[model samples]
Target chain A: MPEQNFPQGTDRRPFADGDGRGTRSDHQARPQGVTTVRRWSNWSLAALVVGVAGGTAALARTIPSHAASTTTTVVPTAGTTGAAAGTTGAAPASGTTGATTAPGASSAAPSAPKPIAVTSPSGVTTYVMPGTASGTAAGTPAGGVAGTGGTTYVARGDT
Target chain B: MTARTRTSAPALPDAWQDRGDGGPIGVAERPAIGTTARLAAWPAERLHDGAAAVDTVLDALDRQASRFRPDSELSQVQRSSGTVFLVSDGFAEVLDAALRAARWTGGLVDPTVGAALQALGYDRDFAAIDQDAPGAVPQGVPAPGWSVVALGGRLLERPAGVLLDLGATAKGLGADRAAAAAFRAAGGSGGVLVSLGGDLSVVGAPPRGGWPVAVVEDPDRADAPPSQVVRLGEGALATSSARCRTWRRGGRRLHHLVDPRTGDPAEGPWRTATVAARNCLTANAASTAVMVGGADGARWLEETGLPARLVSTDGSVHLFGGWPRSDEAPVDVSAGPSLSLAAASVGCRR
Candidate 1:
């Protein structure tokens, strides 16, 4: 029997998406909201401001009554919730007012996403979310494309 | 060799030792699971801790997954072959990785080749195998296919005669795990690189220029100079070749890479395939599958968009998916092995 070939690069996808149990359509359907939020989070502030403007204009035309009273809350973009909040301003139909902010942002700007230490099932590999330093010393800035550091040889074949 | 029956954490082997003096980048090397395990960490101070963490991971993997060890969890599963049995978490995790690789490559790099390998006279470790041994008549016992092995939660079920050899994916997974462990041990601040028999993975922040690696055709040949040196900032790099790990059977030279379809050593156009991926396991899987897929493998690799270097059996080189050009220019992140966009064009050609 021929083997089933999944979409390539599934290795880097989230555990849920890469588990081989879900189809591409299933992924698109299940993560629709989360995907939108993640996409918004990756946008630049300029692009986001333009998006907000366009969204507010659309809302004004669609729901004039709510638009007058609805204040567009510009949640600082950084954390997961911040990204989710960034999209809420455009969603007047949901009854979310500009006064409301992301759950943690109510006190102050949401802090940068903390690096969560994720260990593999076997306890062999651990992936620390990029950006933040938890219990250790201050984290150094991530580097760019690999450049010549020193010569380390990698041979063919599994030794 | 007595099989270690203890399922719990096994003691670190005495062979684990540091190599070379403390330098800008600390390096340690030790014998592990029939291969040499090497670890390099930035900020020399973290070397000791990183080495310790790597040692722990490698040892645990050997105890949990070594097929040659009669006491390993994999051996236990094989002993109870064909029945539904509960597997330890570590064993299950490794098996999951193996199965995933098989699925990704469409069984070209399957784990169910244990019986085929044994029939090819590769039942023992490479070091212990007699290269001169007479070959048995080729049984052409094709692998039962990875689909036969079922793993759910902790319960695994497979037919009685299906044996699994995790050799293809286990080491790559080990490198990933060891690198992660080493990075965590270093307080998750500096960078760590773990190479298990040349399949290497990097984690945490890299140095100013990323990790420099010299890609070689055959690591077994000490005199073999590097073909190319590429700096890897993130993820991992792996090479698979049919030129190494060979034994003579009935005067026929055979390699260890078995083609599941034919139950014979893969005889593809490419003798060696090297790929850079977001992780070591993915890289290893692609490289191995390329060796088995031959010319078609090159096409498959291009579709995946992971930077790959394929050396044909005639010694001609073919670069695909934005692999570093001969000019040695820095890899263009936009065009080079972008893991996010890799799936954009992947499909089954056959």
Candidate 2:
């Protein structure tokens, strides 16, 4: 694949009907009597906007929990030490789904139970440390190209 | 914390922590990505192989996305003033993730705050930065914001002043990618879990009891006690703390988790926010956003029904949705030489 580029300002779309000239001419051709009709139309539009806005407010007020609260019981294996011991009485939670904002909601987050504090397991944290690299670029590897479109999406390999 | 001078690849063998005791499950830890990376898997013998595979992906991503590295692709993009640039697939994915997070949070987690971070004295690795370094003079110019970025496939168009930073999502994304790579290379048996700092991701089949993760308020402080332990059957968990990676500026303490809207550290009563989701990326975004969202964070988590645990500035703990209760006994995740690998290899019956 070859790299492609778009000139700046391409994100803006041009007007239809020959670049706005035809649309302007059509607007000018409207009959003068239509001005009164336009006023009535504007009032009707305002009423519709208010109605929709009110309905949206009502919908926002409803709090919905789509999933039934399912709990998993965690049992501690005997002889477990440190924080792992505290896992015995803990309840497993249903995984997270994406969230959308609700209007007029309280700014502070709702509170839940306080978590038990346990020391970091000495067994895991005791591992020997390794040396760190300053940093390096992943320049095109043997299987991938640099800037050319020849690059393959390795990250999505399993997906 | 500022960037610590990158040393060299971790020493072989000795550098790999062996938490295995002839058990079916093997655990290993290595220092990488400016933090500790822990990998857990079944079949103890293959643990090192999995870690190596993950390192390949992470090392590449670090080079591409790290802002601390002058030669990184991100730094190059920042230097492309008013010009269009081409990016690697990995770099593009990082940018895409950051963009999606901003959009999902309504620009609450915007990546355009690179300049804001630099202005706050976070230009280098956390370890290299001076806590009492002279405060930065605000450029008076705000970020160009995420809207002005035009990313059409691999081609990226910058509006001259905008700076791109992947700090918000890179670690979690790396964890996800590393876990996937490790699992794929680990053969058909066992599961793989990778933790880069506090961000975690898992792939493949889990052990009979699932992986046990300790939720801690401050990840930077390895000595700080864990607040809770939860079994992750599958998916990721990420915790962001406003208390960590902080420095004193003009007698006021500041942290690295910057709020793009104000070009300043987020003002919230909560000191740390931890969230669990289907992947590390989403979990990280939600955690960071919640830290900045202040009082609104809990409501958003509740409305979304995402299980989360938060620690307030005064050291109070709060849970939302179905986050595991703190009172429950923690599951045993210890690995021994004799633990049965059959659970991962032969497949355990539910």
Candidate 3:
């Protein structure tokens, strides 16, 4: 439903593929246009350009990922691999999972984030797009008090 | 409501002795060049060793519990290879998990599709397999279901030649093991966290606050910074879905998360589901099972009383039982404040 805007140069699909960058038109700005760079001395100028490019590149990089992530909030997750599907570690003695959000959220419905599934045990994952991570699952711990059979989420040292 | 009291210091084996050995949550803490009386606690460098630890468990699983392993205990007892053998105990831990999950999802999370998965596409270890030549996907391969296998405490037998795929359950168990190791090594008196892939659990409060975690939307963006943050203290969380994996064979796209009923990758209303429990094993297993449950899966999760969040295929989030959104400030309140809050929030979830 949200895909109809197409923003600028997006290829029209059934939905906004959830890539999060809004539309594709904003994609090819060559990194430097979003911000301005006064050409400094030759060495300084080149450094400035690269630095500026690098920063923009970083921003540009996060933009789509964030966009895609935001979109993924709505996407089904199980065995799909791409974007967030990247793996953090092999099945481990030292594995770490994705970031943890808190419990008892104040009901705010912003756009959702979609995620890909990654099998850390093998370090190999199949992503939707070739470059994303593949993660297997996301956990949302319900709050308002631990119930029977459900282990209560206690803060460290509270017990 | 029953309250299980705990006050014992966690104990662990030698693998986590180093001062820096707690596990990762999302961007796993990787080891840095150190003057080592202690080792790095990061996730990458530990791959082989970690995999070895996990494989050690799996190998034993096959030897003791699997019906597919030719030389495993279950395998040896079977009258012949033609018979699908199902047995219990060690190997049954994984099977029991799969069976419980299958019942939870109404068979969407069946673990018996190993053979059909291979026949349709994925046959070898993910690392060793070659991609299929792109083409039309053939239809209707019956997924091998857990239903095909029968089991009890130490009893299990399956249909002849039922290849088993423990992909889902294995990860959860591995995460629990890894995190438990870290928690124990951390002395069980301080903050600790462990995460394998996206499955995670926390044992302490992070320096910034409760561990500020992010549930990544796409696996590709895994290394990319997380967008949503979670304030984790002492719990586990896992997300399950199939929004990636675009391998084509038989002229069709085949993804993972195969529906045991259809024997093909799932086509469901929900795309991702994250289940949070006391440990990664429960969270991981439950998340995988919810994928199999579809819409009803969420309701079932609510009743079972696990806190959960489900993202639908059409792009909707179904927050069941009011999962506490971990985006708030990681303020380190006093023990009194924490205890008071804990006491208050407890009855609320019910």
Candidate 4:
């Protein structure tokens, strides 16, 4: 078998955990890196001062500086709350009985995108509701086209 | 094929009349990608430029992936069966994607249905397909299967009689590509949403309240009211319906969503299944698979945790994966609103 070089920093998981950003779950195990940022900032300033005194501007450019720390915060939106409460206009039409929730869905409005199964009149189970998360599939290696970023979707049938 | 013949005038419904009305973003529409495409972008000034970028990508994909065109790269591969043929990067990517899809769905979404589609009188463009004529009986030949084809990097080798049909997957891939390109063309400072025949992708930052998309049962049904309207900050949504692209074969109604197991059109309980995935391609695949899997499809989607919305043949609606339930009354087929205006605007030049 040809060796598949799974790209670094790409989520190769079979299912999308969330918005395709990272595998980090809803709960963070550790706090944001405030001390790390301070340390890096001090080191960079010291290096710049030394380089400038030595008149080696080129050396300063080549020296590695720790990346600036960035923090991301996730906030609940009105759409989510309204949909969970079944009050949003976007929700399924009410009084249109026979809608079934997925097995994994929470009773409360779903915080993460979850799969839904809807059965038909023939009693044949036949539906999965889509979610709003993006670029969450296991990464498809870059090849064959110009643009990259986003997950791949495929469908087939038994006929 | 020439550009004129490539993109025919869009035949869209009047239901699109008030979509995105008064939204802060600018929207542009054009007849391309074998369907009407809408590009909604922030910073209204970049809307036209973003649409143009999408058009370029779609046009190139059309040339490389159009199975109907004898000169297309995919056609060349079909004709060059039994030999290793060097294909375009786009063709290779699509084929690779098809193979991956087959593996992903465990052969549920096979690309080997090309012959089956052709046998069903879908040999030409959908417009040129003879819907009234009876479809031919399939030869009972299972597609060579995805395993028979080998991809050595960019080179592809397929046995003779192994025809490939990208269909929904190609459209999904194209939508993903177009959406990403359009977003980048806007200097990545604005959000961009690309909808190709209802299979869409949203990238960058979405407008306030997110991108409002009305999901309906039959996209071709001008009289059909939207089953639901959902917002998307980013991601993709696709609807696959047995009710559309339909024809009569021996007085029996048949549609394009085929089952690879029988080499014939699929007959399922669900009239339409819409799926939302991290990307357009997966959403299209899941939606189409739901058609073949029928009741089993519901279980599979649930197990996989993919969100979806499905409408049954009896017009009973179903929702899962956080798909909201609307307060609006159920769609009354007999009393559903009609296309009040025949001349609905589909192409909006920025």
Candidate 5:
């Protein structure tokens, strides 16, 4: 009769008497129901934690070393030579390579790519190569003496 | 006719001068591309035609590569951040030369310093920049690095917020272009010299004794005699100086040459670098790299086997890679009239 008085599906048991103590059967049923619910919650929580940890570890393994590094790749155009493809790191080191203080004395010689002269239909000559040339044939003889009559000036500009 | 005395001023229309020796060479100059453009052509009659050709090349270059121009192709590329953009052949050629210079110089001469330049208050033309403007100097912003830019054929792609400034190579390319065009305009027979600002290029056949180039300390001081005079048989000559195109911000003087690594004006023992190479673009790149490379630049220049003249901050001159020495004594400003020529004709034959 007391059990029938309790609400259906309620885990909370009613007091058996004025002393506020649950009946013997009510107390026994409450502990088993609580343990069962707590065990299920713990298992679910543990599975979720394992899944999340596994995912994080997997993601950590997939990252590339150079993901943080900046890389530039330039495909050589029609007339360029030397390193058909080149890649420079994020921060290029200064004065370590490419050039030296003395001619023909560089320990780390820079690549010297000859420029290919391309003559357009409009008579414009474009140097298509990217690197310095071995020599040019357009100037006066290299040994020609300089004269005073027709001298031009080369200086820094405002641009 | 006796060669009329030439004044060290921008030689516009009426100012064209004939060589006092009455040689076939005539010199003409005009303001162009935010700087002065000078043309020296053989057969005095060809000077006008050469000038026209030079103008055409410079105008085209300005429209294609100027960072200060809102509608320039470079500016459009800047705005297209993170998008692939197709470039014209001319733009691609100039850009290729810039990248090659970057690669050849080990990134010492970078084109990606546009943002850094703007941050330094050089966002507009040098003449328009106010040195005394009130503002705090912004923190140095290292360039995005040239590596961030990708160019394949006419296609260019870069990350968001990357700005490209072709100031390093565009002028030289323009000079080279102008010289070739001028040479063609001159019937493609006689020699033609084109100097945009101080990037000088020559094509066809040089004069009897090569083009005599006066390497001066400061281009603005055109009236001051040069420290050295060199001869370029065919190639190109470019001079990069920290003393020119300078401004002040936050009480500190800044120059146009920004070290992409530091995002600030380059500071070095050498105040100026003048280089001669097989072409204008190469010459400009080497000279600029020398200025930006600072103390290490001299050695770098020597390695390239190109002739160079470097002026120290103290005004001392050092020459390398077979750069001819000046026979004439250095002019003293204190000694009046001796500096009348503006540039002393020191025979640097060979």
Candidate 6:
């Protein structure tokens, strides 16, 4: 789909009736041949305003489960985990969903839940999250996507 | 929407905490002092999938429900009196749910309160509300009940006199929508949990049992304990709190939990009521009702057959019927593996 460059009040239907100008007059609503940086700035600012007010209020988010030291897999985007207690899923060996626990396994009271180790694909920068677990790495592969990564997987009894 | 930071694909870890046993197993822990989470995952990228679902719904909300954008249908109706802007299913559903809640709450939680809320010091994000700005809440005359904002099979409403404040319900609605999307994306088998701020909903089960969740301290309470843990799965939960807002007037403190009868801060026994329903909106409506209905509200929720956990002003916890239960035995904080993909396969392209 091609984008459009609509300017302010581009529809000239208001002047079509010839209240102030006749239909034959060159009064159609259209922009001049030249464009100014100021116009783009206004458009950008308006978009930013809408984005912040409209998007952030409902956009994606995550936080530690304060009520429970629940294990969060922060499953890498596109990977869906389901009931594969023995990594029995047709997918990867992890076989977990939304970065959570699997079936038929004893729960381990690890200091911090172990984070699986996944090295970033080539050229995909790996960003380490500060102030979080340092084991079994979680999070997006790209560097600086803090919210994308899972907390480091800490072995049981090892904080 | 703050230009969402474009995140690249995430790298998966090499191993998870492993337990040799292989049946559907459930695990939980107290992340904070009070909050608890029980998790059952079959094995799919549930978190990322869930977040993706949230983003898609939020994108639609912007296009359909936004009043901030001048071109939005909401804004159009706001500008014209007695005019009904036929809206899409998504927008209409949100408005319908909001109105239903408004009427059900006896007008205490009205969307039209947007004007009242804006006139108050909360014109911006709660974070931006000035603490020292001195009490100067613009007095707003509460409008008619939601019945005044008509609705049928199609969109019908004169929004000029009534501002639709789906603020409280939007989160709940969004959570359900996102969870549904995630479930669909993941082929609709494994358990799914969608938590937005304080509102959350779940579907299916995790790997083994259900998803455990926690009710954390009021971001305002520095010394608040985190013992509050609720086992949540296959339903939704929400909590409303006024600890985040207060107005000082002649030694009395006013909060945001408003009561329509008096159009003032709610007088109540419980500070927070977390209700679980099939969807987040229902949970939210119940939570808001608790703040307004007070003791009666708690009873009302119990009567409605929805599971509820109400925390009183004194920190006592009341659990309703039908709430999920861990092993009536002591909850094991940890003793199981995160997930294993052996018998049950939870991760398949949805």
* Clash list (residue pairs), candidate 5: A100-B299, A100-B300, A101-B299, A139-B233, A139-B234, A140-B233, B3-B20
- Per-residue lDDT, model 4, residue B1, is 11
- Per-residue lDDT for A60-146 in model 6, tens only? 332334324344422111113232212223232222322333332224311112211100001000111211221212222311111
Global lDDT of each candidate: 0.61, 0.58, 0.45, 0.56, 0.59, 0.45
> Interface root mean square deviation of every model, in Å?
19.6, 14.5, 17.9, 13.8, 21.0, 20.2
Clashes of 5: 7
lDDT of 2 by residue, B1-350 (tens): 11121122232243456544435556667666676677777655557668767767766666567777655677666655445665665666666677777777666677888788778777777777677855544342355678777565565666665777677677777778888888877784567778877688777765543455677765556676667656655677778877677777666677777777788888898888877777777777778878878887667666766667788889887866556454332222121111111111121111
Better of 1 and 5 by TM-score: 1
Docking class of 2: incorrect
Please give the range of 10 consecutive residues that has the lowest summed lDDT in model 6 chain B. Answer: B28-37
**Model 4 CAPRI quality:** incorrect
Q: Write the per-residue lDDT of candidate 5 for residues B103-202, one digit (tens) a residue.
A: 7788888888888988988787666679676678766779978877766655655566777778878788788788988888778766777877778877
RMSD of each: 25.2, 23.4, 27.0, 22.7, 24.6, 28.6
State chain A's TM-score for model 4.
0.17
Lowest lDDT sum, 10 consecutive residues, model 5 chain B, at B331-340
Arranged by lDDT with the best first, the candidates are 1, 5, 2, 4, 6, 3
Candidate 6 regions with alpha-carbon error over 4 angstroms = A1-159, B1-49, B66-72, B106-108, B135-140, B220-225, B245-252, B322-350
lDDT of 1 by residue, B279-327 (tens): 8888778888898887777777777777777888898888776665431
Per-residue lDDT over A55-76 for candidate 4, one digit per residue giving the tens place of the 0 to 100 score: 7766565553322111111122
User: Which regions in candidate 5 have their CA more than 4 angstroms from the true location?
Assistant: A1-159, B1-23, B328-350
lDDT of 4 by residue, B166-268 (tens): 8757777777878888878778776777877778877776544345567766555556555555555557777888877777766766677777788777777
Better of 2 and 4 by TM-score: 2
Give the best candidate by lDDT. 1
lDDT measured at residue B189 in model 3 versus the true structure, 0 to 100? 34
Ranking by TM-score: 2, 1, 4, 5, 6, 3
